[model samples]
Target: MSATENGWQPAPDLPPPSSSVGIIGWIRQNLFSSPLNIFLTVVGLYIIYKAGVPILDWVFWSADFSGEDQSACTSGGACWVFVGQRLSFFIYGFYPESEYWRINVLFVLLAVLIIPQMIPAFPHKKWLGWFFLVGFPIVSYVLLLGGSFSLPHVETEKWGGLMLTLVISFVGIVFALPLGTLLALGRRSDMPVIRAICVGFIELWRGVPLISVLFMASVMLPLFLSEGAHFNKLLRALIGIVMFQSAYMAEVVRGGLQAIPKGQYEAAAALGLGYWRSMGLVILPQALKLVIPGIVNTFIALFKDTTLVLIIGLLDILASVQAAITDPAWSAVAAEGYVFTAVAFWIFCFGMSRYSQGLERRLDTGHKKR
Candidate 1:
């Protein structure tokens, strides 16, 4: 026996504990204890070499980058130069080459509006509501779609490819958010009629698929209109997407509302805050913050769903790629077109998800600290 300050310690009469006795020892005893591990290691290395070597060779070592046309790419490897040649058309679609700068400016403005909102240090969060929620869209529409002032009118029919996809997704998120908030409030309203109406609206839309909604917009929408009534196809799709996505947005917001403790409501009531005041000042800010990640994910899903517009005959990015490949001159390069589209989609989606993760961290505020 050994004596210590706090208590008696075990006597050092037994052999010292071996380092390789727990997890490391167990691994050595089973995995590397015999000839099987060495054999498996060798087999794994061989498989890696067999698969990776040829792929690395074909993708980069033997790939063609300087070809004038697909015919010049005879190296039995990828021909990425085709993408470089027609990249602008793929991104901007039928948007006039001369007016491509307007799209560029519009994208920059969106980045400016969104990026500042993501940062916690921005001085005027409320101002962003007016600017991004209201001003930017009007400016972008006037600048890109043109017509209102002296700007040349660019018909919505002319919009296609990635530009149309961006437009559709942007409009969906822009409209869905405010609409969702109202729906959430309505669902939680004190009045039975308002609550029932909001619940029915949310559930009905949520029950139906987005494709069905798009179909209704594409087919049934025109029939319901008065004579001589004309609607833009893009606008119709935008409306459908907004309506479908808003239901989902409402549910996400409702989840956030449910997460708020009753103590918060009680405290707000004790402060003599009215319903709207209590909700806006206390409940929504916290609830919305808690659900930011979910909302961003919904937006991402809506962005991807924009591709489904191809089924209804709208030429978004995916349809544009399909159109490109169907051209006889580019038939052999279909794989390249699809790959280019996939890469572009991956870029946009990955960037959005990363931004959402950042927002989650920024707004956590000890509620969900890692």
Candidate 2:
């Protein structure tokens, strides 16, 4: 009778045992779960502290923020004053300071359009895309060049700094993607002539280093033209970049296309859709989604490669920084300039990486219930 009345059910599970339930438990399970892990954690923390403290002190506490020259940097820390002094040059290069507003306007417009396009919830994406792909280029060309619209003419040669870097990368990406897609398609085409041409073109460019391609474009290209014929150096560089990059891009895209299941093609054909329609509607969307990371990697590489334009005499941001550091007053702060440039590049590349990851997550149709 006593046993029948005492039904307590083992104290209702006892709150998961204290050792496995709280903050201390979490730390034990994660950081110091094993002797090796504990040792590694301690060593890593010690290294970070030793390396980080001096860096933090140099970058923040002891840095010269409001000084005019190297004399102000006597504290054995970064001379941010050099960065402040030549910040304009690092950003705008030789572009006339009076017309900096033009670049500002372009930047503002890009932010307005691009920020929205990046947002998944934003409406009117199709219209925004049309404007971005077509209208914006025309408007930018008019605003930047300006000989036809009563605005002062600013030659392409005058473009430099971050502005030129952005221009070349943006143009290369915009033009390369579609051209690469076409080449990828042509490479896989049933038509012998198209396949041969595509293969030859891709092989020729992919076989050469970008430096060689740029040299050929800049040096050999002019020789092939008539004696009086002239081409813009920036344009020549852009052409070489597009040609070189598109070959790589085509390979990336072709890999994506090949990863796609043949069943998809068969399904689209079963629906009576033609080759272009099937690709545009079903195949490409999926293929492109699968290769988002590859495409982003290519883009990051292209962005960094813009620095190579310096070899051909275009003053990109890196070149501008180099030029600024040569000034006797700031030459001692070359490290600071380089660090700033590296940080800028890191920010842009990191942003692209984060965006690609987000896009991949969003487009992940293959995920299943875990």
Candidate 3:
């Protein structure tokens, strides 16, 4: 006989106690799980109260948001009026004001091409991928460089500010990954000459400081090039950045490759796959997945390091802010200007980081599941 039928009338399915679930439960579990945790939590809260309140007040409340000039700024809080006035220069730098719509169009086109490619369920992905890889470059080049179809030529020298920064970073990241993958493969090659060459190349680039590379590319190398053989300064900087960053990326990719099980390589061999086919079809996908965080970390570093272009006389976003802050009218806005740049960098880097985490979770391959 069942207990319920025997008059045991199961206690009316009581709800869980309030202390076991909700905000109170979370607080208890995380902050008061032990005496040490409780003490640490109290100390942490005190620190936040002491530091965060003033920072928040300065960053948001007392700051001068909308204004014409420094005259609108008070002694209290930040002088964001300077940032407000020069916002356009921060974004577009010296790009022609009338041609702003071209850049906007490029951005729209990029989102159209890239968003679809990023989504797995999207149709025509193969077409979109080809278009992004092949067609978009041509379109973007023609649009930005603009000597065709009645669009006036905008010289590369005029490119500066955040626009310049993004261009350099985008080019570096796009070119670096594939070049690095090749270098990593070469490093692990069976031939002594190829392995030695890749190792030497990676070590040579990694040993030098980035500033030195930029200096040689921008200032010194021009003197050595044949007379009348002109090269764009931005292009030179790009080459050096690609070469340097690829070394780091190669190391990251190699780490991922090394992490793959030996059985994977043997399995591919047993399937009668050639070396290149095995790597492309079986090994590389798993290897790249394992090192998503490292790759993203390198990307973030490259983004920030774009600021170093200031040394080569290229005015990246940080340089633009520095130039604006140096103006006599906005002389006191150095702190606010730097803060704005910091926030801008943070947004892009944080976005990459969060995206990497999501990608890792999505491509987890059952390794992290029970």
Local accuracy of candidate 1 as per-residue lDDT tens digits, 161-260: 8888888888888899989999998998889999999999999999998999999998888888998997878878888899899999999999899888
Top candidate when judged by lDDT against the true structure: 2
TM-scores for every predicted model: 0.84, 0.90, 0.86
Regions of candidate 1 where Cα sits further than 4 Å from its true position = 1-58, 114-130, 368-370
lDDT of 1 at 105: 92
**Distance from true location, Cα of 281 in model 1, Å:** 2.0
RMSD of 1: 5.2
Task: List candidate 2 segments past 4 Å from native.
Answer: 1-4, 7-20, 263-282, 289-293, 367-370
lDDT at residue 9 of model 2 (Cα atoms) = 44
In terms of TM-score, which candidate is strongest? 2
Error of 3 at 226 (Å): 2.8
Model 1 steric clash pairs: none
The lDDT for every candidate, in the order shown, is 0.85, 0.88, 0.87
What global local distance difference test value does model 1 have? 0.85
Model 3, range 209-305, lDDT digits (tens) per residue?
A: 9999999888877888899987788888998899999999999999889888889999999999999999999999889878877898899999989
- Per-residue lDDT tens digits of candidate 2, residues 193-272? 99999999999999988888999999988888898988899989999999998998999999889988889999999999
Rank order (by TM-score, best first): 2, 3, 1
